[model samples]
Target: MYGLIGKIQVVPGQRDALIAILLDGAREMPGCLSYVVAQDSTDPDAIWVTEVWDRQESHAASLTLPSVQQAMARGKPLIAGFSERCETVPVGGHGLATVP
Candidate 1:
């Protein structure tokens, strides 16, 4: 499985709005196993997004999806910058279905 964990820095006071945009695009994604958006405990303007997909290609393809594209357009202005990003290989975990 493929995974991505990233930290996004939002414009001051715009984290919630950004989160809403992110969540809005989280549904109806093919090959998406999980898409989680979390607030950084210590940084009001920082958000964390973790995603799991059936394969690397699926994750890449998701970028071109209309819902994701719209969310990116809507959220662009609220983003300050990206702080960090990590690619991961998922094995097995609760809430993650076994993809055979």
Candidate 2:
């Protein structure tokens, strides 16, 4: 399984706007097993996203999709910092498969 945690920092007051774009993605993107976006109470401009994908390939491919691309475009100007990490799990919790 593949799980990703992404932390994004936007230029002040931009988090809500960014989160709105991300929320739009949740409606139509494919191969997404789960997704959550949150605002950091300590840092209003900071946003956190956690996503679980059926496979790493689906998640990776999503980056190139128009929906995702558009979302990113809306967010580009707002971004100040970003960090992402991915993990693989065999069992016990949420797990993802390799791209087929």
Candidate 3:
């Protein structure tokens, strides 16, 4: 399984709008096992996004999806910067169905 964890900092007062865009784009992602958007506990302008996919290629392909592309275009102006991004290989986890 492939996973990504990213920290995004949005322009002040724009976090909720950005989060809404992300959530909308995440819906119906092919091969996506999980996708989560979280608010940073200590930073008002920071948000965390975590995703799990069946393959790295699927994750990459999602970038070209129309919804994702639209979200990127709409959210670009609200984004301040990215703080951290980490890629991972997930073995197993709760809520993720195990493949035989």
Candidate 2 has its poorest 10 consecutive residues by lDDT at 90-99
Report the C-alpha lDDT of model 2 over 1-100, residue by residue, as the tens digit: 5678878888887778888988986665577767789998887778888887777887898898888888888878988988655475424364432333
Off by over 4 Å in 1: 97-100
Angstrom error at residue 43, model 1: 0.4
> Candidate 2 local accuracy as lDDT?
0.76
Each candidate: what lDDT? 0.92, 0.76, 0.90
- The TM-score that candidate 1 achieves is 0.94
lDDT of 1 by residue, 1-100 (tens): 9999999999999999999999998778888998899999999999999989999998898899999999999999999999999999988888974442
Clashes of each: 0, 2, 0
Candidate 3 Cα errors over 4 Å, as ranges: 97-100
Two-way TM-score contest, 2 vs 3, winner: 3
Candidate 1 positional error at 3, Å? 0.5
Q: Which should have the higher lDDT, number 1 or number 2?
A: 1
lDDT of 1 at 55: 98
Name the best candidate (by lDDT). 1
